[model samples]
Target: MRSPCASCVSPGVVKVLIEPLSNQLAKGQLDFIAECLHGQESGVMATVFKVSGEIIAKVASRLFLKPDGTVISNIEDELLVQQILVDVQQVLNQGESRVKSYILPSGIAGVFLEVIHPIVPLVVFGAGHDAIPVVNLAKHQGWHVTVVDNRPGYITFERFPNADQIIFSEPQTIQNHLDLNSRTVAIVMTHRYESDLALLRTLLPSSVSYIGILGPKSRTQRLLQDLKSEGFLPKDTQLQRLYAPVGLDIGADSPEAIALSIVAEIQAVLANRSGGMLRARFGSIHGEEITCLMSV
Candidate 1:
C-alpha cells in the first residue's frame, strides 16, 4: 500500500519511485524512460495526484504502464493500477497525454497520463549533398536517422556525422540492413534511375508510414511503369502512402530550403495534416485544447 502522506508532496521536492521484480535490481524512473527510448518502446507514465485545494494539487504515486498491461511501481496494492489500465490504454492509443480524476480508496485522485512514443526512424536512401541537409534537419527534430548508399565512398561517418547509422548497401541488399516498421519514414534520392526503381520496388509494399521520393512526377511515373513491368505491382493502398515529387510547395530552390520543406511534410504526414496554411484554419493550432477532468 502507498503511504497516505505520499500525496502531500511539497514544492520543489522530487517524488520519484520505482520497484523492480524480486530478482531484479531497482531503477529510477528516468533510467526506465531511457531504457524505453533505447529500445524504441511505447508506454505511458501515470502520476497520481491529490487535489489539495481549488488551485493546487500534490503528487502521489507514479507508475509506468506498458502496452501489455504490466505496471511498474513501488505501490504494494495492484488494484489501483488495474483499475486505471483501460483509461491508460485509451490515452496511449490516442497518442495524446490526458488527466483524469478517479474515486480511489483514499480520496479523489488525479492521474496524469503521459504518452511516450518511440523516436521516429528516418532512412535516407541517398547520401548525396542534398541528403546531408535532410539528415541534419531530421536529427534536429530528434528523429533516429539512417543513411544508406551503395557507393563505398559516400556512406561514411565523416560525411554523415549526425546519422545514427550509415549503411553501405545496394538496393538489392538494403532490406537486410533495415528494420522497417510502421513508424519508419523513408526518403529516396539516390539520383540513379536503376537504384530508385529497385528501392521503390522494396519500399512500396512494406509497412513504412511515408515514402517520399525525390524526383519529378514524370520520373516517378516512369519508375512505377518500370516496376510494374518487372511484375512487382504495388497495391492502391501502398501507392497512396507514396509521396513522389516530395516536400511541401514552398518554392524550395536551395538544398536547405528543400530540406526544410521535406521535413515539414514528413511531420505533417505523421500528424495526419494536409500541409496547409495554419492561418486558414480555425480553432486551436493543435486541434483541441486540454480540459480539466471532472472530479468523481
Candidate 2:
C-alpha cells in the first residue's frame, strides 16, 4: 500500500527539501507529536525515504519514532520501516540529526532524520525579586520555567508574567508538585537557610541534571552538612551535579547580570561544555562539525 504517485526523481546526490508540516503529516499526527513534546519525550521525525532515484515505496509521508522503538507511520513496507527505525535509534543515541542512505533490493533509499527534544524545564525554588530575572531569561530562551515559593504572596503572576507555572508549596512538599527528571535544572535561591536546606535534601536524590545553589560556598557546605546530619548523604555522583555559588564567573552584582550568568551556566551544563569564552575555542562555536548526509 505504497503512497500513490509520490515518487520523486533524485539528482544523484542528496538534496534536502523543506516542505510545510501539513504536507508531510496529518493534523492528528501533529497533535500527537505536540503531546510527546509537552510530556518531555525525545523522538525523531523522518521524511519519506527516497528509493533509488525515485521515492517509489514511500507510503507514509512522515514518520515519528520514539526512543523506545514505538513508531507512528502508515508506510506498508515493514522492512523499510524497520530500517528507518534503526536510523532513528542511532540519531537518538547520538543526539544528532543526519541523512541516512540504504541500499535495498529496489535501489538506494535515503531518509532525513530530525531529532526532536522537549523544552528544557527550569525550576526556580525561590520567587524573590532575584528569581524574577532568572525566570525572564529562561523563558526568553524558550525553556519551560516554573517558579516555586512557600509564600503564596511571593509566587504571583504579576511578578513572573511569563512563567509557565507558579507553584506555592512548602519546601517539604515541593516534590509532590514537581515531576523532576533528567531534563530538569533547578536553582535553590530561597534566601532562607532552612528552605534551601530542605530543597537540597529533596533535589540531591532526584534526577535533575543541574542543581544550582544561589549562595556562597560556605552556605552550600552548611546545607550539605545539615542534610548529612539528617542521615541523607549525597553520593559522589550527586555532588557532581551540584553547582554551588551558582552562575559563571562574570563578576555579576546586579540581579539581571547574575541571572544571565546562571542561565548561561545551565545552557553549558546541558550541552556538556565548559562555560568558557568562545574566542578561545578553535572548533565551531556550536560544536564539532556534523556531516549532513552519508550514503552507506
Candidate 3:
C-alpha cells in the first residue's frame, strides 16, 4: 500500500516537515529541502495538487522569499512555489499562523501553504543550581529545553519541572542521548573544567549553530589552549560560532540576572543582531530581512 502524504496526517504537528509526495523530485532537490527544513524555526508545509485532487509536488518551508520576492531552492515550479513562499513569508514576518491557498495557471485549485512557528530548542549542558534560572527563563519563552548532567543527584525532574528532558550522562556520552542540529542552541555551564572541556571538544566538531560557554573569557582561552595542546585545533568557523563568557554584559551578578542576559544574547544571535541598544541601531529591530533557513 502507498503511504499517505504529509498533508493527510493528523492535527497538532511538531517541529518537523514531512513531504511523502516529494518522490517526484530529483534526489538532490529532496536532500536540499531536507537540509532547509532541518534548520527552520517556523514549520512550513506546501502542497501542490492537481484539479483532480492528486498530489503533484510537495515541499516544506525551508525555502524563503528573497527581498525581491524570489526563492533559492532546487524544487520544480519555481515561480509558483515562489509565489506561495512569499505568502508564507508574510505570515512568518507578521508572527502569525495561517493557511493560504493559490491557483496555478494549470487551473489547479488545491495548492495550499501552511506555516506555523515552532518552539525553539535549547540544550543546557549542566544541571547545576545556576541552570535552574536558565531553564525557567527558557521555558517562559516557550522553548523546548533539555538539561544534561552526569550526576544523578544534580539532574532531577523535581528541580526542573519545566524541562522537557533531563538526562544523566557523562559529558562525552551526551551525543548518544541528544541530537544536535543547525537549529539547536547549546549552553555549557558544568562549572567543572574537565566536563566543560569534554563538552566543548564534542560540540565544536558538530553543526550546532550556537555554543555558549559560561565563565570568564580567560577561562575559555585556557580551555582552547588545552584543546590545542591535545591536538584539537578548532577551525576558524567553529571558533567564531562559540560564545565564550556567555550572556550579555548587563552587570548580571545573580543567577536570574545572568539567565536574562544569556537568553537575551541567544535571542539576539538567533535574530542576527549585535545585542546592542536599539536606539543606536538602524533599520528594523527584527533585522533588515528575514533569513529563512540560514544558520543561526
Candidate 4:
C-alpha cells in the first residue's frame, strides 16, 4: 500500500526564499559532514533508494542546513528530509538556524536516498594556468582551498578571488605553512624543477593523503631518484607518502583536461577508490575504510 502523503515523496518540489550573498565553505562545515558519515549525529538518510516496484522514497534535504550549511548542503540526509524541514521550521519559528550539531527524532527516519556532500582541502603549490581552472572547479564544488605560489602577481586575490588564502612565496619554503591532515590533496603544478623538487622534499614527510606532481612520468621517476639521493626519503614513512606524477592516466593534454584528471584522482582517493570509475570497480564504495578512516 502506498503511503498517504505520497505526493510529498514526488521527488517533490522544495521551495525556499533566496537572498544574494557571497559563498564561503568553513571548517566547521567540513567537520560536520565528516561526523554525519559515522552516524555520529543521531540518525541520517545515507542511502539512495532506487525503486522499481514503486517510487516510495522521498528526499527533502533543506531543513537541517543552516544559512552557511544551506549554501552547500553540508548536512544532506534524505531520511531527515521532512524532519529536517521541520527542524528548520522550528528554528525559523524561533527566528534562528545555526547549531554546532543536534540529534534528530527517531520517528523521522523514513526516506531512503543518497545525499552527497564532500570536503577536501585543495592545496596548490603553484598558481600556474592549470592550477587556476582546478581552483575554480574546486570552489564550485564547495571545497576549502589554500593556494601558494612563487609569483605575487599570479597568487593575488584578483587572480584567484574565491581561494581562502593566496600566498606568494618560495615553493620549497612554503610547505612549512601547509596543514597536511588526512583530508588534504596537494597539487604541485610548478614546471620548474627547483620549485617542484623543493616541494617534494618539504612535503613528502607530512601526514597528507594525496600529492600529485604534474609532469611527465620520466621526469617524476628521475625526480624521485634525486629525492632519494638527497636523503629526502631516508625513512620509510617518507617513501610511503609520495604520489609523484600525480593524476590518473586519462590521456589528458590540455590544461583543463589535466586539471580534470587531477581532480578526478583526488576524488577517488578521498573516497578510497581507484580505476577512476564506480561501476568498473569492485566491492562497496563505502565500507570499513569509510568508517575506520582517520576522519569520517
Candidate 5:
C-alpha cells in the first residue's frame, strides 16, 4: 500500500482515518469513489473526503458536495458528474495520488480532490523461456500477471511458479482464459506468426490500454498487412495503441534486460508518458495542472 503524502496531514497527527467499511469496498474493487468529502477544515484547511458507497453506482449517481454545502449522491447530476469525471481523468492521467483544489460555481472555494487507482494488470501471451524473466519481473512490481500459451508443455506451473495464472489455451480463445480490461497491459511474444496474428486480431478490438508485440517493426507491419488482406481493417486508433518492436531502445541483449525494457515501456504507457529521459523534460515530472469546478 502507498503511504499517505507527507504534506497531506500534520506530523504525528492523523486528522482523517480511512478504513473500508466492507470487504467488497476494498481497494481495487470499486471503479470509482461514491461519496467525496468537500468542506473547509479548521477554517483554512481545504479537504475532500471520499468513501465507497455502492458497488454498482455510476459516476453520475456518485456523491459530491455542492457549493451551498449540499451532499448529493442518490440522484444523477450530469453537469456536476461531468466535471467530477474531468477531475478523475486528470488524476488517472497523472498516474499518482495528488491533492488539487476546486472552486464551486457559487464562488465557494473549499474542495480538494484525490484519486486512488487500482493495481495494473499485465498479461503475457507466451510462456517460453524468455517469458519467464518477464513474468518474474512484472510480478516483482506487484502487478497481476496472467501467462497464457497454447502449448501445454510451455504453460506449466513449474515454469511460472510466481505467475497468478497459467492458462493453456489457443490464442483465439484468449477471452475465455483471461479477463481483458482497460487497465490490462498485454504482450504478444508467442514467436509464432500465426498465433500472434490471431491474438492481435482478438485483442485489438478490446478495451485493453496497451498491446505490445515482441518482434521487429517490419514483422508487425507484415502481420497488420496480412490482417488487412483478410478483411480485418483495424481503426487508426487501435493501430496507434499497438507498440510493435516492444520495449525501449536500451540495447537489451539478455532476457532480463529485455524484460526490463518491456516493463518500463508498459509503465510509461500506463502513466500516459513518453519513455524519455526526465532530465530533458520541463515542468513537473508528474503532469500538468488539473483544474476542476465544484458544482451541482
Candidate 6:
C-alpha cells in the first residue's frame, strides 16, 4: 500500500519511477520486492509489471488515481505515458489517501525487447463516429487520447466509452486550452474542413509530435496552401511532416478501414518509419528496416 505525504503531494514533483526488476536468478524472491517511500508525499506512482512477453508500465496521475485503480496493458492499458504530466496531476490530485496499494506485476525472463517510449501524449481532435475505433486503437497501441468535439451530443461519456477524456467544445477553444507539447499528437477527422483547418493551424506551429489529416492528399495540400496564405505557415518539422489522406494507402474506404490506415501511419511514425521501402531507400537504416530486427 502507498500513501502520499501532504508536502510532496501538490501540483508538482511527479517523477517517473523506474523500478527495474532483477534478472539472472533461479529464485523469484528478489523480483517481487515492494519498496515504499514517502517524500513530501508527491502525487505520482509509476509501477512496472511483467505480463507474459511485455513489461507493462502503469501510471496513475489523475481522475482514477489509486493503488489498483488503473494499470497499463496492451489491451487494458492504465498509464497514459504520453501524458505523464496529466497522470501526475491525477496522482497529485489524490490529495490524501489513507491506504494505497502499489502492487507489482509478475512475469518470466527472456522475452520482448526493451521499450523506451517517449512521454508524448496523444489528443484526438474529434469525437465523431470514427473517434470510437480511433480511440480504441490508440489505447491498445498505447496512447493517451483526449477526444474533443463541438457537439455536446457526440462528446457525451456514453459515445466515447473508452476515451480518457471527452471534451465538448469548439476545436479552436479546446486547442488553446490544453497543455499541448512536442510529444502531443492531433488527429483531425471531424469531417469539417473549417474545424479541421482551425485546429491544425493552431497546433501546426507548436511542438506537436504529429498532425494527421483525415482527408485526401489534394484536400490537405489545398488546406496547407490556404493556411500559408493566411499567414499561418506551420514551419515545424512535425507540421511539415503532416500525414495527409491519413493512414497507409490500404485502399481503405470505410470508417474502420480508414481508421486502420490513420493508426498505421502513427505506428509507422512511432516505430520511426519513413513510410517507404528499405530496398528503394538508402544505406544507413535508422527506421523500420533496421529497427525491427533490433527490437527482437
TM-score of each: 0.80, 0.81, 0.64, 0.58, 0.68, 0.56
Question: Model 6 off-target regions past 4 Å?
Answer: 1-115, 118-120, 236-238, 275-296
- Model 1 residue runs over 4 Å out of place are 1-26, 49-60, 74-83, 103-107, 288-296
Q: Model 3, residue 19: what's the lDDT? A: 38
Candidate 5 Cα outliers beyond 4 Å, as residue runs: 1-3, 8-96, 101-112, 288-296
Write the residue-wise lDDT of candidate 4 on 1-296 in tens digits.
11111112213342222222223322443444465443212222222111222233332222234323343343344444444454544443332212212234432333222232335677888887778888887778777888898776787878788898887789666756766766577888878887888888777777776788877779988888898787765366655555656778889888888777788878776655674656775764443111110111
Q: For model 2, name the residue pairs that clash.
A: 52-108
RMSD of 4: 11.6
Best candidate (score: lDDT): 2
For model 5, which pairs clash? 37-49
Candidate 6: residue 2 lDDT (0-100): 31
> Model 6 — TM-score against the truth?
0.56
| Poorest lDDT segment (10 consecutive residues) of candidate 1 | 1-10
Candidate that scores best on TM-score: 2
Report the lDDT tens digits of candidate 3 across residue range 91-183: 656643333445666444334343434457899999989999999999998788999999988899999999999998899988899888777
The whole-model lDDT of each prediction reads: 0.77, 0.78, 0.71, 0.57, 0.66, 0.55
**What lDDT tens digits, residue by residue, belong to model 1 across residues 130-248?**
99999999999999999999999899999999999999998977889898888899999999999998899889988999999998999999999999898888899999999989999
Using TM-score, rank the candidates from best to worst. Answer: 2, 1, 5, 3, 4, 6
lDDT of 2 by residue, 1-296 (tens): 11212222332343444333453344655665576577667788776545554434662366778645677876555666779888888878777766666676656666667677788999999999999999999999989999999787889999999999999999999889999998899999999999998898889999998999998999899889988899988999999999999999999999999999999999988877899998899855545322232212
Q: With candidate 2 superimposed using the best TM-score fit, by how many Å does residue 1's alpha carbon deviate from the native?
A: 26
Query: Which sections of candidate 2 miss by over 4 Å?
Result: 1-16, 20-24, 48-60, 74-80, 101-110, 282-296
Of 1 and 2, which scores higher on lDDT?
2
